[model samples]
Target: MHDHDREALAMFIDYQRAQNLAATTIANRRSILTTFARTTGTLVDCDPFTLRRYIGRDARITAGTRRTERGALTAFYTFLHDEGLRADNPALKLPVIRVPKGKPRPFTAEQIDTLLASGAYTRTRAMILLGYYQGFRVSSIAAVHGHDIDLVSQRIRTVVKGRKEVWFPLHPMIAELAATMPNDGYWFPARGGRAGHILPSSVTNLITRAKKRAEIAERKLTPHSLRHAFATDLLEEGVDIRVVQELLAHEHLSTTQIYTQVSEQRKDAGIRTLAARDIPTSSGRGAASIAA
Candidate 1:
């Protein structure tokens, strides 16, 4: 990054810190802005044309990546404009990148059972449960401390995406495990004292290894997939969507609603299967059956 970009990014980083964003979120914003500055000439001087052109340059970039880049750039330019660094926000006029509405891919029940039943170390199993049952982000799981677990109240506190501290009812197994963990430090403490806790990536690596041992096909199964399972499992059992939303700590109902589609899709699949075996789907019975 150029000197101008560095200074601007430093200031923006501080601003993000002031808003109490999670460290990962701040780092991502910095990375996105820095990459944009390095690829283009100057951060402060980029107009709408350059901004859009840069993002559109990569044919392999997924719609999700484009959306993330757009969000970061927009946030950066908006900060610059708000602080009087620029007369106008260049990002304001950048064309809206339409992101496809994709369904959440929750892990199947057998996948969950297989992973949980794997003879992994206790730590790995705990991390998996924290995701699959507790619905914590991997980052949140990484930051788990004995302080976050309260055996007295039967609740565990988690630092979520926005650095929001939320306490949820603790699982008995998690509470029992907490009793045996170090009370003075993080459960997943850094081995080398590089930081307070292990990086979230480390937690992910452990889970991946466990998944491999379970002989599950190495697809895009991730910690987030465990969280998806947590939500989907509840919804499948006819739990209220709003209650699941609260458990997932989703900020918007729309975000939680995607899991509903998962349930609907399963029902559709069953209908199609039945129609295939018993009734011809070509007779429109499948469609009518699904609609009704």
Candidate 2:
């Protein structure tokens, strides 16, 4: 990479760190910017065509990954333009890649029962229950500490993005289990005296093992699937979509609306209702029959 580009990349990384972006995000941006510098030699030379070659139809990465790379480059060039380092942002003109949206596959009730009964330890069971009942992201589940649970009030507190702390009513089963845990540290403490709760990856691993033990055939079942089950179950039961949105802590109602798609059981019930309705059969004497 040219000296000017290297210097610009370093300055941009420093700016990102100052903005308090997550380490993983900063690392990804750094890697993408470095590659752009190496490939194109300078920011002044970067244009829409150059970016297209890196992320467009000819790119080897998945569409989703390409989108991420495009986003990173867009941010970088925007920064350069705002700082007066570049005259224009070429990344802005890159065509947007539309990745197909896949419907969420939630765990069946029977599958959830089997998973719970598959010999998960106490802490793991509590984690699974929280995700299944509360619709918590795995990161939020892992961050839960003992103090976050209020056995007396049957509530649990969690922090979401932007450090927004919210309290949710705890399920009775989860509250009862929380009461049995150590009160001074993490509800799901890290193994071997680590200072914080178990990592999100640990929760994921626990679910994977439990799924295998239960012989679940759904290959897509993961910690997040439990969350999907939580949302879909509420929707299937005819709960208001807005209520589900709040329960799932979704920022937008549109996000929750996806769950409104009828489940198989609900679909069957709807079809049955239609079948129960009576209608006169069409016949050659239909008009005469009506007159009679």
Candidate 3:
């Protein structure tokens, strides 16, 4: 690679670190920049056409992956432009890849009951219950410590994206479990000498095992599925979308609005409501014939 390209890429990565971006984000940016340097030989030589060609060459990747690549390149080029290393940000012109959104696959109430009664360990059951009731992400759930729960106030504190701590009321079931937990240390302690609470993968594995035991492994439920169920259930019960968004800790209202799509059960209930409506009695002979 050209020395200028190498130096520019290194500087860009350092800038990302200074911005306190996540390690995963930095690593992904580094990988994308390195690939660009390898393919185009130098950042100085790249333009919109070069970047577009590189992105289009990888047809096997999903639209989501393409979007990530585009974002990384856009940010990198913007950095270079800001530093006076380039005349323009070529990546600015890159077209966004639009991916179709799929309806969330949440667990049915009966399935949730069966999964809860599937003979899992107490801690595992508690974890599942928390996810379903609170709509917490797996990482947020794993990071939960005993002190985060306030039994007196019936509140549980959790950190969401952007490292913001949010407190919400605890469900009665989760609160009951919390009452028996130790005062200090992780409520769901990590296994095998790991530090802090359990890893998200461990939570996922726990859900998988419980799913198998419940004979619903075929349903392909994950911890996040419970979270989806939580939001969807609240929406079905006439909870406002904004309220559901807050409960789920969603940053955008649009993200929470996806749950408003009517489920099969909700659709059937709507039909049933229409069917149950009473027709007024008519006094005319034709009305009697129609009724008969």
Candidate 4:
């Protein structure tokens, strides 16, 4: 029976939960493990070479993703060893790639203005607000079934993937609009139920179309840029980094520190202002004129 194999997978998932692994991380590993178990019909000994060959099949996956796969496989084997199914963890010999560092690309104020102005009503408004004002992922915004909004409180109760529930306060105008959003449908309703949901793909398409219409440059203009712009905007407004981190629900302070780089631009603007101010002109003839 594959029942024993299924039980092993369940125990591994349970262990991950106990360790406080994020929902996104657990879900991904679950998918990978299920795939492996189904393909092999058992949870047996797996070596580094076999795992490498499995991941090498996916061209679009990054080095980080491959590393995650390795970690998941190693955990599974460790579990098997503890249960006396295997004595050696073969994946201990595998080498994983290092993660690359990159800065986030943020949208300019002008581009944000253009994007907001491009959309007509609900969909456009909701999307723009979600990205800029609320710092919501496209998936979270799209998952906003009607009940999640609390218009009177001016907040949306969002169940963030791999994170705890967060309440996002709306901008005054967005709050007003949200009050009028349909009671039995999506906030950005082109759909019907919780299951009748919008995909991130659709949201991307909408942003692309809107960008073309607004004559905004397509390069580095993505749905996630809205979140970047939101963080940048908060920093420029003199909001503290820790505060922004809480608002974004970021678990790490380092993740929130990226906004500090954006805050430095504001300091530069202040320097430019100081340079632009005209100093009062001094009269060289003042002492002589007073004596006369």
Query: Each prediction's Cα lDDT score?
Result: 0.86, 0.81, 0.84, 0.74
TM-score of 3: 0.76
Question: What are the runs in model 4 whose C-alpha is more than 4 Å off?
Answer: 1-27, 30-45, 50-63, 66-87, 119-121, 188-196, 208-219, 270-292
Q: Over the stretch 160-247, how does candidate 3's per-residue lDDT look in tens digits?
A: 7766789988889888888777669888887788777777778888988888889885464677899989998898899888888888
TM-score of each: 0.85, 0.79, 0.76, 0.68
Candidate 2 vs. true structure, TM-score: 0.79
lDDT of 4 by residue, 1-292 (tens): 2777778778888988997877667788788788876665545655666766776767798877777777778788887777676788766676665766546677788987888787545586677777777888787777676677777787777866566788877667656666666667766555554456676667777876777878877686788888888888888788888988878888888987876765566777878885456666886598779899
Question: After best superposition, candidate 3 residue 203: deviation in angstroms?
Answer: 2.8
* Leading candidate by TM-score: 1
Looking at model 1, how many pairs of residues clash? 0
Candidate 1: deviation at residue 181, Å? 2.4
TM-score: model 4 vs. ground truth: 0.68
Q: Of the candidates numbered 1 and 3, which has the greater lDDT value?
A: 1
Query: What CA root-mean-square deviation does each model show from the true structure?
Result: 6.8, 4.1, 4.9, 7.0
Which 10-residue window of candidate 3 scores lowest in summed lDDT? 274-283
Q: Model 1, 63-151: lDDT tens per residue?
A: 89998999999999999999999999989887888988777777787987788788888888888888887888899999899888888
Top candidate when judged by lDDT against the true structure: 1
Each prediction's number of clashing residue pairs = 0, 0, 0, 0
